[model samples]
Target: MEIKLCSLIALLGFLTIANAQTVFDITKCGATPNSDITAILTKTWTDACASPTGATIVIPAGTYKCGVVEFKGPCKGPITFQVDGTLQAPTSPDGDSWITFCSFENLAVTGTGTFDGMGSAIYGKQKSKAVVTSNGVQILDTKIGTGDDCISVGDGMEQLTVERVTCGPGHGISIGSLGQYAGEMPVKGIFVRNCTLVNTQNGVRIKSWPDQEANDVSDIHFEDIVLDNVDNPIIVDQMYCPSNLCKSKGASKVTISNVSFKNIRGTCKLPEAITMTCSSAHPCTNVEMCDIDIKCTTGPAKAVCTNVKPVITGIMNPPGC
Candidate 1:
């Protein structure tokens, strides 16, 4: 495969600060067995990504334990948390968010490390709310876990992108419709590319409430993604009636348009191959699907479109070419 990928950028202009930025090096800070990391990470000794731009947070190779990591501002602009080790959070059953970056932009997490949200004790009737928070979160060659969404974008989220991310054994990536409240504003300008999934619920999905609805979702594109043992591969199921109380309510107005899928291959072990349940009134249109390959053991490859435009140029399997 080509090493071509786009960078996820968030907006926040910065001017003052040392070297026009700052660096938080956890290694040189001696935050180990002898050092008090919690204190160093506080305003007394240190602070979490505050007033940072053109700055980098370096977590050199080590296993560090933390709680409720919240990034406070200027999280935009070439910020790299070169995670060279594991940053783990406590396990909670009550369902809590591991790391949250709100009202921030231009963030990237890179390294051969992990962020373990020891949340094995948690359970949810659904795996869709955790990622409803921010924008421009890039999981490049990094491992994140436990919490509801490895990464979730909620309200006022635009230009959000997830690339080269490996998520599984946790809640998959969910692009929400923002319901009727904060939960119902609609995520736009989303681009998910070159990612892998293990045992996720729905790989590459666009979810909406059974009741709430958004006006329109423009400039959304998902491409070059892979799923090993995911359930719903290519799901655009806007007809979802959350809790099954009203899947037929037809209040789903989240129009997903200008979507292009290319080089997407996966194995759907549960639901149908491509479950495209859109509104007949305002069916999703201008969708260019090229090179969609799937390997389903039993079921068939069935695609339903109302007023949508799907250009199938490549295939493999019974759904094969």
Candidate 2:
């Protein structure tokens, strides 16, 4: 989806807002519990987005089924999607994204709601990728579980902040599987802090494809994170090729710089707690780590480094490279 010239704020779990005008409740638009509310939600959003002044769209408490839907607009005024109900997706895959928000001026999706993707029913059979391609986005106070990255920072993203999130049963927060296509925009100014990750495949990662177009990734930070039994807790793999599908051509041309990881303490499932395998052609620069204390479940934790030398200080448990 496309979101332009807007602050796309996602406040998950529970929210309370005062002075909300023009309330568009989905139930009033013909939605009932445990039934398909796609049309109702669409109508509600349409009405809300057309309001002369700011409007609020609410999905009240209950279980509801929904299909692939997109909320698109350069809205007339600021819009708030307040979901307090559970929105369950279909068992079968329909589209790339179950719900998408595109091209808004000011939008906030906040709630004590749940989006059940039903990942268990079709985990490995299909691809479930959540890509963020926007600017000025904030994901706060959220709990996420999935088969892929809990939050995947994609191209063209700037000034994004993810805070107070609990992630598990999935890959941790990541920036890029980038450089896969030509002419991808640069990603910068990403901040992820105060999060807890449990049983994740990886934690706080940056991965890009090898032998691709040159795009820059910089000014990334991950801080005050707690990981429990996570694998590859802190990693940066520029040669990211899943399933061995792509042949080795040359090193990634993606420039990675000014990255930092601080106050990260956790237990890793694997021995290699920190891995930084940067591109030989465009080596990562100005990388820093401080106050990291990760312990391995099987043995003493260790770090493996290649191509990039990081500045390290403060309470390194496994020792730095």
The number of the candidate with the highest TM-score is 2
Model 2 weakest lDDT span, ten residues long: 1-10
For all candidates in order, the CA lDDT equals 0.59, 0.82
Question: Model 2: runs farther than 4 Å from truth?
Answer: 1-22, 50-55, 73-79, 103-107
Q: In model 2, what are the clashing residue pairs, if there are any?
A: 2-103
How well is each residue in 113-210 modelled by candidate 1, as lDDT tens digits? 77655555444422444444456756576454444555555656777777888877655666664454533555677888888877776777665554
Please give the lDDT score for candidate 2: 0.82
Question: Candidate 2, residues 1-321: lDDT per residue as tens digits?
Answer: 111111122112113347535776666545689998787677667767877777888888999999889887767877778778889988886766778776555566677788888878757655646445555556777889999988888887777778888999889999988888888889999999999999999999999999877899999999999999998899999999888855576899899999999999989999999999999999999999999999999999999989999999898888967
The alpha-carbon deviation from the true structure for residue 278 of candidate 1, after best TM-score superposition, in angstroms, is 1.6
**What TM-score against the true fold does each predicted structure earn?**
0.78, 0.88
